[model samples]
Target: MKLLEIVEQLFAQYGYLVLLIGLPLDAIALPIPPGNTTLTYTGYLAYKGVLHWLPAVLSAYAGAIIGMTVTYWIGYKFGQPLFDRYGERLLLKPVHMERTKQAYQKHGNKLLLFSFLMPGVRQFIGYATGIIRVPFRTFALYAYTGAAIWVFLFTGIGFLFGEQWKHVLIWVEQSLLYITIGLGAALAILVYVKWRKYVLQKKATARAIDR
Candidate 1:
């Protein structure tokens, strides 16, 4: 069957399961679009008066936090060695990893709070947090707070914009793509700038010693 047909059936028959499973799948980079499509379809259902908005929103919120928590655990467990070996060729470059490390260095625990809201930054932040051995209590505090707000905001969008949610979904997906691209470009620029500064500083130090 077609993909849309499957999405429709899943929304109709197993919306809650989608909420539960989709979150983790998306967190793990499974090519799923997180809760965007699911929430939009649920909104459509709500407009038909067949679904309750509150339950769906709450379920989605809880599911997102749980899913992110699971992903965080996986990162904590096994992400370091794998990333150290393979991150450069993939999305997580050494520079990107260093950027996240810098954020952790500057902000201490607050980077966790902001990571979820960030597009390109969150995945790396998760892994770096693990490598740095952020305490579970601190990690949960920042992660859950960010995840809660993230979930509630998106689910609330679905609940409030039930009828026109298709437009919202399209806009959100497009916006995310743009944001991710922008972030990647920005990271590249920052890496170049830092490298240049470091080279300049080394040259200055060498000149001073020569004198």
Candidate 2:
């Protein structure tokens, strides 16, 4: 059977257990199933009254949190040695790691809030955070919140779309490319606006001092 077919059967038979186990595995970057699709399908099932909404959401949220937490600790404990051995192969030079660390420090923990929205990024951010030695409390706060939002957003889409959730998932996948572009543009605009304001303020201060 196809993977999706197997996933559907698992959900049909196991419901909560499948979500709890599957979501964590996905968060840990395992290749078993598509986490987002599973969550969305669960939401559709909930809409059809085959599962409870609260439990489904909670299971997904908890699973993701747990998986990420484990991955983070693994990076914390073993990242240095692994990186030292395989860093060149992965193109992860010390300079690159240092630059990433600097960026994280400058951005602060709040930057993690959007990590969940970025594919391939969410899986690594936890590991990166751990490697950088971010406090567990801060990690949990930002990461968990982001996970909750991500899980709810996809699941809610499934529930809302009912039988049409598959189309929505396809649209989401396609739109993400555009979304990334739009976000980049928006960030650039924001930076430009902020820089302009800073320049204007500096000029105003100079005028005041001359006066």
Candidate 3:
């Protein structure tokens, strides 16, 4: 069955508990009903008055935070050993990990800040932060903020768009790619400027000492 269909039935049967339970699993990569769709549906339910808006939003956000936190710790404590020992079985080869590391070196924090909004990425980004040993303060700053935005954005879509939520999802997917590219280019330019200044400072320091 399609995920939405399955989700529909679950929501019909379980109501608020679905959000409370499903979102956390989705963060951990299980994605039983998928996070974005679920949130949108949550908004729709609130709009219909089937679920109260305040509790619905609260429950969804709490579930997402719990899932992300657990995923982060799992990566911190056990991710490396599991990858090292059983990477091939999981199809996460050593080369893949190395490339991810290099990419993260360049745009890790930027990606981390918005990772929760994207499906495949949201699942792994928490693990990446943990394995990379990002500071707890930094993780909370970016990850939790992203979660809040993600919850509000999608759920608000459902609330506002009503029956048209699916169409907006399509628009969101298309637009996000372009937005990411534009932001990435801007960040790259900023990084280049900072690097150039640092190099110039080092060169000037060396010349002065030699003189």
lDDT of 3 by residue, 1-211 (tens): 9988988999999988998899999999999988988999899888889899999999999988888888899898898888889988988887888877777777787777788765478898888788766777888888888889999998999999998988997798668767767776897899799889999999999999999
- For all candidates in order, the CA lDDT equals 0.69, 0.83, 0.86
Which residue runs does candidate 2 get wrong by more than 4 Å? 84-95, 108-111, 181-211
lDDT of 2 by residue, 26-130 (tens): 877883667778888889989999889998999889888987898889888888788889999998899987877877877757658877776676777888888
| Strongest candidate by TM-score | 2
Candidate 2: worst 10 consecutive residues by lDDT? 27-36
TM-scores for every predicted model: 0.76, 0.78, 0.75
* 65-153: candidate 1 lDDT, tens digit per residue: 77667767777888777888887768787777677667666775765685655665555565567765577788888887877776665
Ranking by lDDT: 3, 2, 1
List the lowest-lDDT window of 10 residues for candidate 1.
27-36
Q: lDDT, candidate 3, residue 23?
A: 94
Model 1, runs deviating above 4 Å: 1-4, 80-102, 107-111, 114-125
